[model samples]
Target: MKIDGSTVLVTGANRGIGRALVSAFLARGARRVHAAARNPAALEPVVAEAPDRVLPLALDLTVPATIDAAAQAASDVTLLVNNAGTHAVGHLLDMDLGAVEDVMRTNCLGTLRVLRAFVPVLERNGGGAVANVISIGAFGGTPSLGGYPASKAALHLMTQAVRADLAPRGIAVHAVFPGPVDTDMLDYVARNEPAFGDFPRAPVAEVAAAVLDGLEAGEEDIFPDAFAAEVGRVWRADPKAVERRLSGIT
Candidate 1:
């Protein structure tokens, strides 16, 4: 549960939230942090920051071989951050079935594959923690980005079930529900769905820092930013209300 002196592995470590997480690991005194991305070459800049502590690993959640290779290479991982995910921007009704499938494959099945490959590594290390970067939209969805939220909704449930299943193994699973993050992706989403433009966007650095804080504190459900925490409170009190609010059905 502790970050200091722990060996960490973060997926999707190329840029945005993932990149910040890599830095957070170093700042929080992780003994080693394997920064894994589809394109390991993109991780070079992050790995260079702390060449001694940061290791670049080639990992594509959707690619089983890459996931297996990363797990084997980062066998010492004490913490796993399932941050790699894909989003399909559109109304659920309008989105292509294939696009939805891709989202599910990447966000849900991909994460499962990585978890399956890495659980043994964690067990071998005696015990460890897993942090899954889900989204607030899991409880509901916006008019746009339907497939993205649907994928996250599945992951949200998976994280919960995994937490219960893994707790007995001395492996803690933390679910992170972040709201809109200030990234290129956010801008793209906004362009696709103007409604999302109204929501506040959290900085990537702050979100990453909050994630580490929650992990170190052993929080089961982490809302890393103000907007997410606010939504989390309501969702905790009345999930249906949050659902209705997002659905514009209230």
Candidate 2:
């Protein structure tokens, strides 16, 4: 999909990869970008830089009302990026059931809701693209991260399902799998657990650039980071070997 002149909507745009995506999209000459975050005020810098091209929108994907409002606010969008995600960092058995539900609600259900709400808008705009920012964890188990991997796994499957469902309507769905990005999400884990500090982390800009490149190339599965691409290859080669590698990553 041609990013230049396309209208794009990026969720969780306040920080991390989402913030990078907003800047990258603008740099690529998007006509307009709807920067949606739980706290809309956090997108001040983004809006300041591209006031005429950026729309700061308040959105909590878990809440249907907020999703509705965000969709209405970004009705002109032709490209959609689902970047918001929740991670429950503990054993599922030991973790609160509510936290697990939150992960599922935000990462999977919320993404689907946004896509459903925007399909018509994308259709109206002449069938653009939808990019789902998934994670390498989706391809293999990361027991230490608790329900995070399971949630991503669901998103992985959902990405394919969405591609199948939206293809007929001219909407293209792309799944992006990034490994250990240098974002606040990784910091959150590192701060709480020292073991997470050792994982390799790539800058957000690099991952965002790869995703945009993948979109331009019409790739169905985008592995923006090298580690993630290797993980995919290993996964296809030997699932057990990939699992061992993930487990070994402190």
Candidate 3:
């Protein structure tokens, strides 16, 4: 759907790709944007950019009540961006079970909650689009991040299933797979874990712009960067091989 003059609700809008998306939407002439994050105060700088157009809301992914509240507050939303997610740092065997669970809880279950709450709002508003910020790693090949890839892969499957479910309802669900972007999340990973230090990163603004472009073009699956597009090609060529490689099975 076109972003111009459309109302959008973006989760995790305080930082990273979410913040870039908020700015990109404003640049593309979005009428109104609800920038929802865990702490609304963190969005003050964002609101300062376009006071009349941007509104900040409190939405903690772990808190279902807050998600429902945001949906209630952003009643005019025509587009929903599920961009909030957490990365649990560790390998599968050594990571604490709770940490791995947190990754799944935030990336998958939390996003599902947002989808459930805002889907009806979209339908009521005459149908719009839902952009799910998935990961290129979901298609498989990240050395670290504990259960992060697994969580995203699960979310990818869910996105496909939900797309089918929403097809009849006129609500389009788009899965966005982005490779390393130069964001705080990536910075932390690069600094703490040497594995990702040399990984190529696309600029946040460019990736954000690509996301909007893909949405307007009605692309069902969007690889917002060259690396992600390459990953998509590799995944498409041999899905089973990618799976086996990711699983460390020869």
> How close is every model to the real structure, measured as TM-score?
0.97, 0.96, 0.96
Is candidate 1 or 2 superior in TM-score?
1
Per-model C-alpha RMSD: 1.5, 1.3, 1.8
Please give, for residues 1-250, the per-residue lDDT of candidate 1 as tens digits.
8899999999999998999999998998999999999998898899889999999999987789999999889999989999988876876786688888898999999999999999999999998999999999898875667688779999999998988899899999999999889977788778877777887899999999999989988889999999999989999899989988777711
Backbone clashes in model 2, listed as residue pairs? none
Against the true structure, whose TM-score is highest?
1
Instruction: Mark the regions of model 2 whose C-alpha exceeds 4 Å error after superposition.
Output: 248-250
Our model 2 lands, by Cα RMSD against the true structure, at 1.3
Per residue, candidate 2 scores C-alpha lDDT tens digits across 1-250 of 9999999999999889999999999999999999999888899998997999999999998888898888777889989999988776776777788888888888989888988888888898789999999998886676667778888889999999989999999999999999889987899888876788988898999999999999999999999998888888888889889778776654
lDDT of 2: 0.88
| Superposed model 1: Cα runs more than 4 Å off | none
lDDT agreement with native, every candidate: 0.90, 0.88, 0.91
